[model samples]
Target chain A: MVHADSSRFAAGMSTKEVYAQVLEQARTLFDGQRNWVCNFSNTAALLWHAYHSLPAPSNAVNWSGFYFTNPSNPRQLILGPFQGQVACQSIAYGRGVCGKAADTKVTQLVEDVEKFPGHIACDGASKSEIVVPIVKDGKVVAIIDIDCAELNGFTSEDQAALEELAQLLAESCDF
Target chain B: MVHADSSRFAAGMSTKEVYAQVLEQARTLFDGQRNWVCNFSNTAALLWHAYHSLPAPSNAVNWSGFYFTNPSNPRQLILGPFQGQVACQSIAYGRGVCGKAADTKVTQLVEDVEKFPGHIACDGASKSEIVVPIVKDGKVVAIIDIDCAELNGFTSEDQAALEELAQLLAESCDF
Candidate 1:
């Protein structure tokens, strides 16, 4: 039973349990809230705190955020709401992890960012990352990006849950 | 000297010195960039990391973020980029601390949010808060909000620096 005023969630829950709660809370939070700014902002906060509430490498996550297709420049992605250190403000459509997701319209589960070609190292502590594109009408509208301090921090479970979240976002948000 | 990719600043600096760097960084970050989302996102990031790099009460800050006037619903402000737990998605104009600042178009440096009438407690840990409205053409387009974990955590100096930042936001960003 989470309160509306507090972002705190039950700690020590399994990662799957946490992700499930995130989706549940997101549904409740997104109820009647069609604004992308509000939805993405809260989602970033939820993912950031959710990962921190987990154990071991999950807790080592250093970034959780979103990058939206720049309305000003459809060829690039602009920074959206996020909970992390300052990041690159914009990434070209086909460059970097976020851009790759945006360009390919595919989820990128990078086990080690250093090994990924053309990786943009925004935070030195970020060793691993996963990016999921929020596609709308067969086009990439936005991307959810999470970074961890440890290599191989995200699992296939994360990708699956986030892909589900992307679907919900596509349907729920009026972006 | 701090690197462009790293949000980490010099840790031993005074609050004033840190704020100075924040402004400098803001100028540089905002250089030729007019997108409000990118500007606000980076500004929140700078403020969050700047406070964290400081000493004592400054480092005790828990929330740093922004809220923008919703175009679809001009009577309310929607959440923006932030580096803290999830916050209230929307606050009607003239309602809470943020709204008071938005309505009054004045800097609100509340030492005790509990005593402030209509204080919206998004984070229970927030004891003090500073909200500065960014006015554009005689209307508030957005606001810069920061929350601290300790009572009386902010000083007159904080208000001055934030007000200055507000002016910069008005000039540097196109909302």
Candidate 2:
């Protein structure tokens, strides 16, 4: 059980810190899993699990599930492992935040729920969200997504750190 | 035209050098093009153009022409841009070198002609070639291909440089 102070993993931490923390935590959490690299599915599962176990965690953030799509249906991302209430299992590319992130491969960190165009309300209370593209061999393979129940929850540091972690996953994992 | 010392862009150059020179020269060659991204289609075009322009370039390198497929049709890489007499436009995703690279985002650098499995002989003289994936988001969207008329023509540096160039394109362009 490797634990870092919650303050160190705050929204506005530096890019280096955010990435280092995710990788460091992931390594600690999944070190025993027998795989060269864990896919987005596994990462999401771990994040959900961590969110649930953390003390004084908010209810608005649903840390319950993840999803992926096969090459035959590249346009959609299907649900994978998750922890809170059940979520919409499928999202089309270009539809919601998930879709837009998949289409552009650029991170989208939205501070307000109402401002986002085509915001998919899996949890209506989710006020802020951060979505990062998982790139492998120069193309987007999947995405790392975090949603906050509170408004203005994410920062540039969060975005940078998640992007680095995404890059590391891309290099090490197959999917 | 921005003519590089052809020797600087030699067959044995590192992957980084290959990427830098290709981009540098390409920028000069196609100065005003809006999208400078490389794909299987455009990469094939680059090889075709290079084969025709460079003096006494190896005849054994048979990048004379190539094709790629849209995801809708997995049967082949449809007839794309090329510069040679005979070319195969469509190839199954599991069939030839191009298909294999598409299947796995890993770079395939072939040194000897006869040793390669599924060597699609568009031209029998092609003794060596290198294929690097052009990734966007996390998927392999295209491949940067280099073929030499001579045996064992590509090196690790060439692979690394081209991979770096591929990364740069993925970061800089929206393809």
Candidate 3:
């Protein structure tokens, strides 16, 4: 089992209902996923689809998951876990939160889309975000990102939880 | 020019005429060798040599430096930088200031080594000590160590200066 919670499993739920339900489930799931959790647009898409289709859903919503036009020549997010539709695999530094995190070596957590200075709207529905830097040897190697549809969805508990997760990832992956 | 001042240069000079003259000349030459500062051992060695050659040289001297042998392997401070011949490279966490700094991720400046519980004595002549951790990604990666012959050899100013230098190295080096 890849660690799923029964509490999030709801009966007689619509896709939107499931989306709402699973997200709540995912909060705990993500927290338990090795103390760090990140998702690309694809992962985001998969999450969206999974949320929409509680038990068994269609792939329609899945297709529209993580999609971002590359601002840099070679845009990719490298190898990590993701969901939803196919994502632009590569991204450049200073382009996306993924890129900017690489460039600045700083963790970025955006609570609202409108307030984000350079908001890259991969999915207009995503309104909140948390990006934790995975650093090694005094350098930022990668980031663990989580996107949410609700505003102010992430809290300090989320931040602390994710930070610990990031540390675990850095230690395990040798980042 | 790689940021060297005469006063700072003099801080690294020794009282011995031969060593003082050599350090003075080395300061000028060191400008071009900025990129050469690598590894905890190398920086430790440089600081050790510099401290030993200070203007007001101590009569009784003791010195040692520490390195992280296991990146994830906790509980040990492998010997790193030093000036005097006596050294204990490998020390367990909770044993000495070097190990304790790594354990606590806090800088430790002790006026007298004797007062510190579990102080590991690589050199019996050492009466005072300072230890600063090199932190990255919110974790302690290494430490800058200083040992002196005189009691209360390290002041707050020395702590601050060494801390600044340690941070510089922490930000500059890869590991």
Candidate 4:
């Protein structure tokens, strides 16, 4: 059930339903996997399918992945598992959307990446973005980062769903 | 130049040319970064674009990634950075293509995965596979695993090119 066949999102599924399945599948995939590497890797793949399986905005997602808190340097976030083109290897705390999320430990849902001050363009195709910090034991462990090709690609419902997924990741991973 | 923009594979390129560019770009990407996690993650993305940028069997690739030797359990390969659906969490040495590569420290290129005894089907869509071992200090550290949708997906050229990549990884990564 943890393999790829079990992850296929059926046709005509709502975005809410898609993400719901994503969360449920992620939970099933990562149930006993405590290693952050494996968990984040599968999470990225799970998000990739969930978004592409939908229509319009969510289907336009160009990237879905994680930026883990570098153990050697907590102030910097290191690129982890991702489903996209090559990305920025490291982002300093408070530098960009990802950094802001990590520094503030709050979700950042930007309608337009270009308009976000000091945005780090990992992919030029990314028009909108969302980042949710994964907090464990009162400290940030990692962040879920998603980028879409359309402006205002994500809604508050997405944030709510992803935040719940973040909560799941916070408890699921050993990072 | 480490960003994703530089990863674009132009239209109308040969598989050999694409891989050459992949290797060149990978060297530049990994120039200053020694962490295996980042290197492997970016490498997967790079390969994803490279293969999809090509035609036929190469473009049919559904999975590209690495499975690192578990630090605590050397005989097992823990899933690492990847671009695909959720994959198997771990494969024991000599258990499958990835495992065989790790166990033998040699590249395993199978035209049809089903024909390969003891193959592990992480994705049912994967019909062919290639696994290249990254050897460090005369020991296997990790393996590059690529899966494709059609039979006879990989060739001797792919093996040679990825063997060169394995050498690059062996030298570049700390792990």
The best candidate by DockQ is 4
- The numbered model that scores best in lDDT is 4
Residue B32, candidate 2: alpha-carbon lDDT: 31
- For candidate 2, the per-residue lDDT at B146 reads 61
> Candidate 4 residues B109-153, lDDT tens each?
999899998988788789999999999998999999999999999
lDDT of 4 at A101: 99
Worst 10 residues of 2 chain A by lDDT: A1-10
Report lDDT (CA) for all predictions: 0.87, 0.53, 0.50, 0.90
Model 1 stretches with alpha carbons more than 4 Å out = A1-6, B1-6
Question: How do the residues A69-162 of candidate 4 rate in per-residue lDDT, one tens digit apiece?
Answer: 9899989998889999899888999998999999999999999999899999888888999999999998888999999999999999999999
lDDT of 3 at A122: 49
Cα RMSD of predicted structure 1: 1.7
> Residues A1-175, candidate 1, lDDT per residue (tens digit)?
2233435768678988988988988888888888888898888888988998898799999889899998867889988888888788788998988989999999999999999999988777889999999999988989999999999999999999999999988899987
For model 3, residues A106-128, the per-residue Cα lDDT tens digits are 76666676787666654565667
Candidate 4 local Cα displacement, residue B83, angstroms: 0.7
Model 3, position B164, has a per-residue lDDT of: 67
Candidate 2 residue B114 Cα shift, in angstroms, is 60
Q: After superposition, how far is residue B39 of candidate 1 from its true place, in Å?
A: 1.3
lDDT tens digits by residue: candidate 1, B1-175: 2223446788688888888989988888788778888888888888989999988788988889999999877779998888888788889999989999999999999999999998888877889999999999998999999999999889999999999999999998887
Pairs of residues clashing in candidate 4: none
| Candidate 4, superposed: residue stretches over 4 Å from native | none
